[model samples]
Target: MLRFFTRSVLSLIVASASTCPARSSSASRPAFIAAFALSPPSAPSTSCQATMTASVAAESTDLPRWDLSRFGFSSPFSDEIDLHLEETAKLAEAFKAKYEGKLGELSLLSAIQDYEEISKRKTLVSSYLHLSYDVSLDDDTLKKRKGALSQRQSEIYGDNLEWFSLDVAELDDAVLASQYENDPSLTKFKSFIDELRRQKPHNLSKDVERALTVRSPYVGNRPLVSFFDKELSLMRFKLDEDGKEVNMEVLLSRMQSSNDAAFRAKCLQVLNEGLAGSVSRTAALSLSSVAGGWLVENKERKYINLRSRRNLDNNCPDEVVDSLLVGVRSAGIPLCKRFYTLKKGILQKTQGLDKFRWSDRNAPIDIGGVSNEKISWEAAVAMVKKGYNQFSPKMSEMFVSMVEEKRIDVPAANGKKGGAYCAGVIPGVGPFQLLNFDGTKQDVATLAHESGHGVHDILAYEQGYLQYHPPLTLAETASIFGEMIVFRDLLAQSSSKEEELTLLMSKIDDVVNSVVRQCSFDRFEELVHTAREKGELSADELDEYWMSALREYYGKEGDAGGDSPFDSYENTSHLWSYVPHFHHVPFYVYSYAFADLVVGTLYNNFLTNKEGFEGRLLALLSAGGTKDFANALGPFGLDPTSSTFWTEALTAHLGELVNEAEKIAKELGYVE
Candidate 1:
């Protein structure tokens, strides 16, 4: 989420987390496979040449890889990267020499402009390296180069520019006011400056800040998270008794897609086993270190609680997050139970299964006329484009440009990162999307989700680099909304009651995943972090916390030992070790739940009042971090601050989805 090894230390400190969920490996295949038409028999020599030519053509049709040259580098190892790094370092030095201790006397506008320029240059290099490192995680040379560059960037920013914020925060209010009045351009950064001022209470001494920044690359969660990712990338799971081992991605994909109940359970077993032992212990150590570091920093900053720092960073109040969590537990949890209860009945009747295991949570149900074939990459792109076009032509055009420009990486490969994410490098440049797409319905939805992030980045470009990134709470709005529109388009295209029911069940699964499941993750983090404060949490202790949270949300009306829909928690307790968010960004899972409900409300508004909704929604995305969650939703007649807002939204949106899916299932005789 922080681009763990690739982004500059300064960017890590200031930038919002990228829109990536927990890491789960899935199946991988060729991006695009060209269909060849048969021809009449011909001469052997001519046919051989023709076949070779056709092979080349098919290879050319493969999904486009990212063109990193756009970042002024031919490759991660290009000389241009070093040149830019040197230039940025020189510029940082000059800027520091000119205005390190004389912030009040110089033109604030000029200083801010110089700072922005330096940040942009550093970010360009960092983003390029991060993207490169993500695809080539197995390349040790690239990994080392990325590490060295990251350390140098950290040194440059820490030694030369760390005092800028401290000095600005220390500036008298009257002085800042005068600068804004005298130079209207300075007003452009008032919000930026005010944000700094808001952190005045937590601002450490300039020397201390510099020390912390310079040492960041060598210490803290970054290095540990990097190690965790590398370990995860290299892990292999046994897929069959023949000893055919696959990467995590393939195993996870099989777990979800395999129709054989025994095989699905086997995939889950291998997945948990692969993540056990050394990997699990390493993950536990890394997580403990992260929580320990966060606790120390929060204590130093005198924040109210563990989550308050992230809440403040998101421009969301603690009470709002509290209300959101409470609502999810009270209303959202019940909705989850009901949905799963219905699903249990459907599986029992349709598949003749006696028990429902965690692997069956995403299992595909057999339905008449529902195709299990993979959607081709090209077709997936067109489907998402049509979905966007249904909402806004402008957005559809932007999505097309992103694909055409080769800014998206669409295939899953060995050593490539497992999850999906969209990284917004800077204001002027479009974001790059990384996905381990295996051509499932979920992958199509993920494509829509990340494209939504890209469009959000494009729409917010006018806000400038400092304000372009939205708060985490609002970041998922466009992505989820994009997913919803595409879902509706898919539903509209369904021709049969069986197909409709299948799609409806899939949508309900996603809703529960995005809302209740994510809230459950948040609860897990809360437990771990809270326990971690007293002492270091052991691997077994982390497992306990995980199972506790799992049962709380996934468990049903009866006790854990009774007739709960889920099987025993043995296979899933270690799953907490693999989620990257828990390591990269603490307490970040709740934002997914928050955004899903928010999008649900806005989506409903769009459905009821089609007129001007596009403009309003685009305006909300365009506002970026400038507007807080509440103010951004003001136009939609929604108030997230109200105690009942989340509960009401959950019932109206997810609850209704469950009801509809259940009705269709019952009508089809799958549920009684």
Candidate 2:
């Protein structure tokens, strides 16, 4: 469930459809933080300071910091950055002058090649600045420097390059077809051209487009989003157990891992209260502005629905996304309830809890022969490498190269961003991973997940910058697949039934979080955006939307005099205020469910037919954005457009896992 920021400068320039009408100054990376709502594995009790210190010091000698020098910059203040910026701007101006009004007359292939080169240089600088900024959010100097460069980029692109796509979109269909027929080299950009053509109906006039792009840095919701990140990162919550205040990441980990039900509940209360007053109000404003701006653009473009814009960008059809959502609600809701019901029973028998509150949903169980110890940084890396090696040696080598090349930042520190993400900057630079490696089992899985993204990036480097990033629907395929292989490898190595049961339950927790919990998140977003059309919503109103979604998915407590596993929603109402994806990308959460189910089917195929499966998966990853999700799945003999594809995948994967866990729980006398 870690975030993957795969968009580059070229993506922003080439693609007209965006979550916001005006593109942000730093839109090079999709401002997605996907792990905020995901469930983490359980661990033994430790003080927040002790945990942070241990995480950093445990492998201080071994944990690798990103070698920014590889990006041709010694530091953020390096003179090379400014030199590169000037060169890129000049190149962009020259490109604009050469092909501003001559796209139809010139060789389409040559124009695109020049565009790609400019995009590559622009991405290199922007990526370094943004990546450097993420690790140290509190550094005002770095922040200001990045902002200035981004503004220059915005102006450079707005004035010099924004017309390229608009002009290309206006090209006659016959001209493009003729170009392709005349020179097969033009075929490499077929997908990229098709995307521009698809946005033709929504394209605004040249002056309007230029104005929006230039004013976006000041007028867009990006400033508000930045405020949200800085404000939340500065806030701290105090643990009731030892009166120690911790940041959001540590506090969330405690809420997920603490064996003590009361402690976990207190942590939730502290978290809720910390985010209550001004924080929630500001977040409400940010969310409303982001959604409001998106809707305005949607209306102007005449998109069909609230999610249509994002679906188009993802290269997924509206009907396919609809099927995925309906399928999850119909089949996934029942499966989620069943799993939680089993969880409630096991907790009742093991911990003697009379009532299962919302906070106890992710509480770790005390199954014997299972370790609650923290994993060391080195051990975690070795474990992930081994897991990848078990699946494919080439993939394992990619993972190792990432570590040896110092392409990963592997510790949690104050002012560092919460959650984890893999930034596929551009080709020839490989991928850089940002992780808050706290040494939990979930942290290990996260390492494996991001490494999967890195491997995918390495394989897809051949696609170059223009079509290098896959749509969101297929982006999570490799990460989730990477996690699954690691889980399977560990499960096979379990020494006893107790260990097996523990692993099964943890895996189920992850799957539910990815598929069911993410669907619920998407529902919450749907309600908020749909309601925001009537004016701004209050923080209290936002809370109601949050609770409504939770109730529908988890079921209300004692509804209709029927027994329900979940307790009343108490401190969970304002939880929506903290999820970054809601504010950053509208309707982006469902992609997690889409990817999980897709990978589930593919993994099943891998288990059943080990022959040539590895090559097929690699090919899919290498295809990048050249193919749509449906066509991408064609090689595997799967069709995502089918009505029952989602349901069948859910049943075959999550349902089967739940059934196995329930049987094991019964045999162990934890459930009747």
Candidate 3:
């Protein structure tokens, strides 16, 4: 299995939650670097280099060089990496022997300290392996090393530390409190311990937990997810651009941006055919295993439903998530339908399409002089920096450092992974960002978004190795905020009403994708998991579930005021197969919706009170997992659990954007 390790034991415990520094007269970089270093401060990185030709650059007009040696290794095959792995294994054995069967007996402070120490060690090694593999997915050596490290970590954990959670769960509350009173050091971990104890009701016996861990590679959804990624890496869609063969990422981007309706349609057709026909059965089996495995485990663990485990993991209540779902279904779907109907009118005038197909959902409206031209790498960075600088100079500085220090790998290459992500291993080392930059406006937003994550990782490092990563519920806050800041900047600076309309429409489209589409994905997962409890679902059945979600969120065809009604999801029935999140992190899609809604609320507050807003926002980013989702947002006067929160956010933010875009369309004579 591909090792997804970061932040040590917490990565496994939290399942994915996971971050570094610099020097200069500004005092910011130096302070961060000093805090990040395990030893003495070192010279700034000088070795990270990119080998991309200027013309062949994918999405990025300018490719970035990433300095990996800053992490203390030159390459995956470095002697230091080998020695570190060996040392990690040795330390794990010793630590296991010392603490195995003694977790309950040890003092709370001692156990916490030991756990933190061991976690730090494990995190550094595992993070290096993962970061290395992420950039070079096609490298067999890195792949093998990553797998070995992952398996070894899992083995050691299953054999030794599997009892840790059970022991923590079973510890008497009074005793734990007494320990905290006796040792002030234990107070720091109060939140962490509280969260562990919350799992008591769902935790299995130590033996059962150990068995699960030991059998993880063969029995869980992760391996199946790995298989899916590998297969997707090989699947290609032939494009009309010079008859070029491209991967799913390229195809999807082209479908969304291509001005030629026929090309877009062909791309969608190829995409649908490629996914539904070639790999649907394999995907179906993978989904079955994932849903079925969760069903079986959920039953044994006594979860309320398939989503219960995820909600618990997110530290959110069932009612809170359900309320969001209900609110989105009731309010968001209609708003989305309204926007798409407006889009249909615009497209009809522009592209002469009487009845839009599913492929037309993402069709861009051509507004002359608005300039959909590709943004250069420097231009994108400048735009992102300007946005961050307006909000927080610290954020802007960090973004610049990432670019100057070559901590980012930009540009899309064949076999390189799609999408964007930021990973930070330890405090002193900072964060690493990966992007397949194809120079679209969307790509620029992705840069801002991932940079936001990097900034969050850096600030949160103050929380230490054990608690520096936020849950998924809060993980997206910084990234989405970064995107919004840049987007709002663009909207404010538009040269004309038409340009403003284009920007407004573009932002609205993104909002729809993030909010409504994600809810639809959540619905699909709900349906699949619910159905899987009865039995395995066929490809056809999964397709129905996928289409059902589409109609629910996007409305039935012809509702968008087309000439005739049609099945909008007919061609994209197999899209669910490509969503790796379904396999890697079940029920994780809703977090995007949660973050978008919450960000809308917070962004409104920032706009209302520009004074000291950055400082307040930084406090939230620095919190890491120290606070739950609600408490983290409490400082901003936002409560996600409130019944009215979702609807209010949808109306005030996304709905308002749609309304503004429609008003603009009318002004432009595209609609009356």
Candidate 4:
């Protein structure tokens, strides 16, 4: 049985909620990395890396196990947990023994110190479960465990929250005894928890917390959310494209790279139709979950505004979000619309691509696929190793061990899920990763990206279970940095201008997705959360908000011609269905944008000034969860606090990329 956190046990029981970091940092990208050459009939990865056993169920029996390289040494996860659990049992006994009908003279601070071992156990369990759930959702037992775990978390939080309320009121003593404490070491978390406890009035009773948790998983879950997330995405739609029928994603992929506006528009229409079709069932579950969770928590938690809790969870102040909205609002009217204006001219279209045509949000730059060209996963691993070796041989070898020892799995096949993730394995085995390796150049980069995470996890493995993975804001650092390594290496090896442009554009679009689009989403979430705090928004109202965000983030300012009809209330993946975040964690979206913005500046700094900066970069990666984000980058001289840190990172390549895009537009006689 998994142990829970108690107020007397831990400093601040996050007794935290939910998993899934991808919604913030990971959007489902098509199976682009399954092939590195960026061509069809994708080849298999040549590496003999170990694979994890990720398998779900096909109805009752099971989904096939996704086999990758496996490590020979028994996973250290069990040993770590056993040791921690033993210590925790001892602590629990001591707590019960010492505090049993005790005299009132013991200081509150002293009381907490007595239970440190138990607190550590809870932390260890949490860290372990995070990775366990990531790789594969096994049979019914695993799903039940997840639900049970969430309930247990609520119970723990309710306990600590009680102690938290008392502790925070006169927090100096609590601060002293807290594990994270005045040690500049814990840094942000110290402040983060301070704020959480500061808003103790908003929190509800333990019974209420447990009720919300127990009710949550069933409210809208399982085969349902799984269906939308895992199955719906994989469903193929046939589209008539010049007589031949094509899959919607395939057609859209072409529209992205083909420079054919009409084709792009047609593809988007069909995609919209498909999105529209699935609304009813998905909507029913989605809305019920939200409405139910909202009403219950609203009454129990006593938050002044509905969104206040979520906003607090995001680690962003309301003011910061407002500033971001200002940027988006200002951006929508001019810069974004201007790009569309140019695109409209190129397409010779009236009214521009319809709402459905948003599938072309990020235009793809195709460096023609070399039919016979091949880049092997083994070779890619070697390249990343060499690249990182130039800086930190230890980091390079760590990645090598990850791939060679079968700590990574990349499979390319039909009926497979889209996107990639680095799954930090439970407790001691470090992190394993998931990918669809179809032998594309980008496929190698994906390996590099996830490998960076794997290496990061391995470096921090010695930190023990409870303190391995860093905050979401810092998690993307190593992965993004790893991408820069391969990209810079590839750019150096490129024989011609076209190749460089291809790699450059690919890398730039990555930035656009990570920095620009994610920032846009972060802004949108802020608005919704804040407004909802004030009052409940209708489903249509929610959609309208999304449209407004879309227009602001992706549309040109001058493009709007007075209240264009958008079915804002129409088919939304929203509704209370499965998006475990709202139920679990609130306002977790900004971390990606934050991480990207910071990393972008760091990458640019390395590019312009230091040729041999890879070593320092690896050193940062190797420090892992042992250090907070700010200190991790201290070696690199990048500070994440200032607006300057972000602006410098964000605009680093936009100017050049925009110039080249404009030049290409002019060369094609599309007019600037």
CA RMSD (A), model 4: 10.2
Location of the lowest summed lDDT over 10 successive residues in candidate 1: 29-38
Tens-digit lDDT track of model 1 for 24-50? 100000000000000000000000000
lDDT of 4: 0.43
Summarize candidate 3's per-residue lDDT along 122-232 as a digit string, tens digits. Answer: 656665665566566677776667665566666666676566656777887777777777788887877667667777888777777666665655456556655666676
Per-residue C-alpha lDDT of model 2 across residues 1-672, encoded as one tens digit per residue:
112253210000110000011111122111111111110100000100001111221213355577767788888888888898899889989998888888778888999899888877777777777678767878989877877776776787778877877788889888878888878998888888877777777777878877766766667776787787778767787775697677776777777777777877787788888889999999999989988887788887778998887787776889999999999999998998888888888778777777677778767766874787989878998998999999999999999999989998887767775555667767887587766676777667777776777787788878877776777788777777888888999999988777888888777877787678778878998998899889988899999999888888878775334345776556897878876666666676676678779999999888898999999999999987788899999988898999999999999999999999999898898888
Give the candidates in order of lDDT, highest first. Answer: 2, 1, 3, 4
Global fold similarity of model 3 (TM-score): 0.89
State residue 387's C-alpha deviation in candidate 1, in Å: 0.7
Clashes of 3: 11
Best by TM-score: 2
- In model 2, which runs have C-alpha deviations exceeding 4 angstroms? 1-62, 240-243, 559-563
All candidates' lDDT scores?
0.71, 0.71, 0.67, 0.43
Error of 1 at 266 (Å): 1.1
lDDT of 1 at 90: 97
Worst 10 residues of 3 by lDDT: 41-50
Worst 10 residues of 4 by lDDT: 5-14
